[model samples]
Target: MVAADRNAGGIRGQKAVFVGPHQLLRPLGEGGMGQVYLARSPGLRLLAVKVIRPEYAEDPQFQRRFQQEVEAARRVTGFHTPPVVDAEPRGRRPWMATAYLPAPALGEVILRFGTFSEAGVRALGAALAEALAAIHAAGVVHRDLKPGNVLIARDGPRVIDFGISRAFDATHLTRTGMVCGTPGYIAPECIVSASVTSAAADVFSLGCLLVYALTGRTPFGSGEPAQINRRVVYEEPDLSGVPGTLRPLVASCLDKDPARRSTATTLLGALAPVDPGALLSPGLLAELDARERQAEADLAAPQADPPALPVRTWQSLSRRGLFGLGAGLGAGAAAAVGVPLLLTRRTRPTGSAATVGKPVDAWGVDAAGTGSPPAGPEPLWSKPITGMTVDHQLSLLGATPVWWNEGMGAVGYDGTTGRQAWSREDAQFFQVQNDLIYGTSLDFAGLVWLNDKAESHRSPLVVPAAQRDEAAMSLRVFGADSRTVVLARETSLTGGGIVAGADLGSGAVLWQQEITENLAVSLARHQDSMLSGSGSSMGLVADGRCYFEDSGVIHAVDLRTGASRWQATGVTSAGVPSRLLRTGGLLLVVHGLAVVALDPATGQQRWAAPATPQPIFGCALGAGRLLLSGAMGTAYCLDVTTGRGSWHTTVGVTTAADRGADYQAPSAGEGFFGVPLPSRPSGVAVLDAADGAIRWVVNSASDEGRWTTAAKGGTLYCASATTLRAFRAGGA
Candidate 1:
């Protein structure tokens, strides 16, 4: 939960910030450990700055061990290692700086592409072996060596996030309850009893990572931490996916008895003389080079304290939703910062849950009113949009429901009957504004617009200076108002991108501005296309100001000029607000369990509101009230205007990783909320919005698998792997 270590009042103490001789630039990311920043030495050399989390730094034993590990890491040297440049383990926040490079990680490559070629895997595996050999030679153990920690640069694979794995060792894992390594790649000894882990633990992790690189799947499979560790401790790996020729070598490294594994030196002897270029495809190489060049160009031209991203992605902050609760595990990621005077304590506020930014005389309470399922009068209709067994996606284009075919375009169904309505394979469904649907072509050369009648036309989406990575362009639609659309072309991972405003109808460019950091793009389950290559939208918009947030800071830009209006900082790094809502006379935003209200024009706080009783996983607002759903099926109702708590209840539900299903904001309607169950047993739990009454519950056919639910107006649409069903208000 430690996001950024904020000492200054807000974002404006920026006369200059530094650690030792390194000048702090912008944030790269944050994790359970601490915030990672992109910095420059007095010599202007780019460096990756890692600031330790307060909780860990505050521990006396941790600070002592951190110094020892830093010293140990400073001794390690190898061709595949990014050398540690500096450290200040006993400072106010305890930080370390390492060499920064423009390489993507093994996991990133697999996600964008697929499996690596055998030769590519061998070359990268060898590079990793060299890194391990050097670390052990320095008498240091890299307890965590998963795909997320290893960087694949133009030179070769470089292992990072070093030395600190044992900063709080096994004894701390017991004293402070720490997790050693990422689930699938963790060595069995590290899990059963951390006392036994050694250089061999690194060897076991390397084996798992190599399997992931070659097969694009973990050898032990992926799931809950305990389940995955159980397999690691007791069962042999499922190496069927690995190349036949390399299976034996990989198996030898994965021996249940850590001491029996091959040494890093032996593996490096085989993997040596690797060709870095062999590990990446030509297309990836081009994209990678372009991104690196962009970063170099940005560094050459220093900004006057411009908002920016990290110079490198050293460690993926998989905790606290830096990427939406599923960072290193995959799914999403983004960071934040607050304004000068707005930062407040993250603990729950004392006001009524129904508290508002300002006093409101009257408001509807439909979100917590007595009600029934929006799509419920029953005789629910079902239809198969396509195949029966692939990962399916569902969203609403106004009242029309659209489902995806993974890589292909999408299909539309009549909301009432689940019957095929109209299909468009040429251009996918994007965003809906003022009853009009907007999308980009498959190649992203033009914009496609569709009317409610399904009639369409194409307009060129002129994106200049955008990088093309094989299938998709880096240009993304920030969002649209009546006349203009906001677009940004990502140039570098350090967040050097170009933003532009264009005429939505003609796609004629109006103005453009170069951005130093990635915008807090407003992304919802179905706001835009679910297609892999289709870019995302910008942050929310209200009162002509496009409100975007990142690093816990909310920024507003004029939609007409693409100019910065104002930045409201002081928001806690507890959690990034998923959606910015415009209700009453305020902008309603929720981060973690806290709900906040800000003035639309000046980004000023009218009045602080109380948060929900538990950590909010999903939420919705209707009839003047906000409904928050937390883990273990706990739900709370608060007045949308005053933030006053009205009701609370627990509707039995599991806290499994259903890939965000159990966390999708509960569907709200006329009189009730429908909480989507995460296939522990696929079902819908309905509760009366008023008084938190348990109305009814209905389970899906066991064979249907996991169900994804969404609501538009008074209708609820739930889609399973093969079938899509529609329901209305009333009984179970």
Candidate 2:
């Protein structure tokens, strides 16, 4: 199938794969991202593959990130994390192949059978403590730890999902603005930024996970993310039912201060009995048994009244005031490193290295390269483009710079000679545009289609002439192939439409399509398929045929001949969906809880997974392996062939905070990093591509330096905000 036709008129193209139907046995469950399926291997070995939400597969950035995370996950050991058996990152519908261990999550066990007794809790706690220690020893931090992440097997407990966790030596994916972790179990420091460190944060999470294992709830109790974050940051955990003997250890682990929190190693030592026989003595066992029964009874009682959540308020007073007002427990505003700046440059001081030479024209040096600009590297080379500006909320397309001007407009530089090839100024007007540095497009028909930063659609061609009585306006047209810019009086919303034709020399428009006063939000295009969406319904063009929806009916029209094709049933919703994405040879319309994937050849149902309207945390797709996010802290991966649960890992809690936290909350500031270390420098390690084994690691846990990125053939550039650094990768 042609890329455009198979897409059903969407920007993303799907890769086709073959799978046996017998691979998938039974359906495990479903959530926001996709479905989990139970599948068996050819040798009768059990495995699982997760099918991703089609919309997620449509996002290139999300897809790349998902692949990176999955690849990194394979490097983790210590028997806590599940092992990845196989994967296909680039596929029609992505999925991961993992060994399907038949262990139930602690949450599932508790929900189905009831809470664990005191003896069981201690044994589980010891096992988990050891597990976390091993994970940390491997230089990993399990950022999200909860009952769901812990599996109960016949031998012991196994932890899963290193998705949110990072190795001690790497630049964190969460970094500045994104906050990741289960709300109820998140560390106190995690609320501030990604600067928090050491295994102590995991220790705090361990406390919460252990509390849930013993009492079947959070230590700080429940609410939305914002509500629970406050309690995690400030309020003391209520251990009313905890036995006196176990209370001390739990409290120590829950210490808000990392220094005070017990190390995973220390906990393991403390768990060891001076005398194992005395651990089961009659008197002691009876006392422990009574406490366990009481706790179980308490757990069974339905909360007569929901625990009172403190009313949160934004406070700008002193740190003490923030604490006093209970605002310290709230989530801090997501922040970026610097302010946003358009295409412009300011000269540095007289002796600054950046200002040493006269600026040259037409430069494009790989930011992901070695520090020394290579011999004959572009004289117009610049380092750290997007990192220089801070606008974390900037859409994925706007997050990075495309081709920008050193002083004038954008210029293209030759890859080999580092010389200016061509430059364009006033070529096209864009309100917001991010360029794609690593994408290719086929020159087909009279169209030069470019898919940059996922959603931006700008066409230098098809600049429509202005009517005498009309005022020239700038229009924002969104679609596949090309977005038209009309400089005509009162042309359309934002003065834009689909480009019919344009003059390259003068940038003039020859033809255009006029959209009615409907609220159009998304558009998709394929070889033989075209789809667009408005507030109430969808419109499509299949094989030169046109289709529109009004009320609850769909009408088809032939675009080539200007005739109608055929209309079918329409979808009804309160408003337009966020956007349309194509995958698995279909066009997908997605809202919070509803999804519809239609065949591009003919507008027919391929698959429709109704939305459950939950906050999606992370999504990934690989061939037959698919990972889906859950409302709770856990995530499920399944096999698409059999549609069965392969594995599940509790990552982060899905909850949004209502009000902002106090800005005055104490910040360790620069002190959080750069502290002189007494031990060997800790660093991030890259893994071998063929196997998930550590290849090399670059340490950054100290007062001396930080890590950053620049493009290199194999070497990745690492830098701090102020200093440029470099690291080498050993494997492909």
Candidate 3:
């Protein structure tokens, strides 16, 4: 018996099943032609195996066409094209396998990270040109070259999925009245003639991909296929965001007249001078390497035979954890398969000063100094506070609320009564851990620690002006038991930057390391000018190590001796490590497009949860789940262990009224999690910790500002720019 037949027991109806020697781990996508599976060869190599429908395999004409196209695909081997590795055209289930590139699809990358910078577009254009050159050289026309078919590999962009590709001399297999490629990306000539497709058609598609990469949208706009095709054939392509340097070349390639379009070879010549390194960052490359390693490990795992049962029964069993073979088809996986598995302000006081026992209306005055009307439903108590910005406030468990503003240093409010418990007029709150508050003053002179009673602990450390001018500085506290606090002072020098750690409590300099000086200089120079933003540099203290990022690499130093522990590259794009959270022995960082969880002891990646399309606002880990929120009001919860999504919810639309409001990170506890609603009727949203179901939405006392929430001891605290309100869960 052939491998396909032997594996027939694993087959259950139309659901994907193992074919031949490749095990279909999961379905990548499905279309009219067939289904694509992320499969693994018996030798453990990853392959995107496309299996033709059984009915199609039985048809002699389809079989012949599949074989011909597979041969042509095999002949067009290039560094930019995923090579066809194996095929069985005559098997009971015809399938072809190609080297699987684990990187995200080009479309996915753009959606997650936003449109590419000019340099990125240039790099992508050049790589696509090279791939097209190879395909045309083999006498094949890649009829489909949309963003979805292009994978963003670490070394360069890779063109993939030659599903509709054909040799120049091959007969047309597509039926009449059928389009061969995606509508918006299809060439005008291909749509108009409905007959002839040449190498020039691929060029037009390349131009479309470039436009999409630069603008995060298709050139012709998107809609129903027929409408899009008409627009493609008649309207001029939109080159709005295309960088001026490449506009003319892209416009030429997208010309309606196929003869006027630039050929792949000509386009390659135009892109030959572009440097791929300028377009790719070290962090991105490191992420790619990690992903590749992960893929290898996943492939190496032995496959388990599917039990003989009904599809529904198997699904139920899988959900119950009786079987660990089935992959989740949740939002995370859906988003992945769609692409192949893809601020502040505060203010001063005003209003009536309401104390703990006062009515909600007496809680505070507005900017006008009149008694401000209650904005949301009445809470347990509300009190007005004085500050210009409330962006960096801390509400630690079992501690009073700590609020920080540029104008008002740090103020602590009673957790239950909304009374001012303490105030540090000279320091801006940085972080609160282990019942101790940490902050820095405006003069860059020293760090301060305040206890719950408002007692102060000062560490006199000053940053020189020269170092401050060259590099940015930040301080963080982390350790396994939350006992050790390390101050990470990063100095960006000319060639690279220096990162020095000091014991926060003792004011003792721990260790210092110099990082990619040249990269730091480049990043600093471009951060303010580039649309993709500058690379982030920041640090974290966690799990007995002082962790910091510089020029796309994450470094960890031992807390006891300040010795280097380990250095991992590409954990995140250039950005500050805004949040480092530890829960269940996993250390989580909100970076780039993922909420990455790492093993605290070894710095090994445990899993990454896919965040929303927008950048994450903050994240919290509790109830065995990771909760993430974004500016768009979207929230996602992932199982802590597996990183599979448990649920996702959108609180409300972000409004301009709340633009200047500083929202506190979401906090989880007591079977509930609280998220600050930043829209009209602004308030706090309490969600069931298990499934992210909204329990209630308690409107805030002020509608027009960013508000943040924290939950602990059955009390939910909501802080707006001018007011801090406390509410009891279940409306107390």
lDDT of each: 0.60, 0.38, 0.58
Q: Give the TM-score of candidate 3.
A: 0.46
Give a tens-digit lDDT track for model 2, residues 1-732: 011112121111111111222134333333224444444444545555555443343334545755776666666666655676655544433456666656656655554455666676777777778888877776667777766567666445778655423421122232224456667778888776556666898889888776776676678764235667888888999887778888999999998888999998899887764322321324434544564464344233221221123412212222111011000001111110011011122212111011112222111001121121111111223233232222111111122222331111333333223333443343322222112211111111111222232332233334323321111112222222122222211222111123222332344554433432122222211100111011112343233434443322344444433344454453322122222333455544433323344565565655544222222222333344333332322223333334333433222111212001100000001101011111123222232222112223344444222222222233333333332333334324
Q: Which prediction has more favorable lDDT, 2 or 3?
A: 3
Model 1, stretches more than 4 Å misplaced?
Answer: 1-377, 388-391, 405-407, 430-436, 465-478, 493-498, 513-538, 572-578, 612-615, 655-662, 703-705, 730-732
**Selected candidate, larger lDDT, 1 vs 2:** 1
- Best-first order by lDDT: 1, 3, 2
Best by lDDT: 1
Ranking by TM-score: 1, 3, 2
Q: What is the lDDT of candidate 2?
A: 0.38
Could you tell me how far off, in angstroms, the CA of residue 534 lies in candidate 1 after the best superposition? Answer: 20
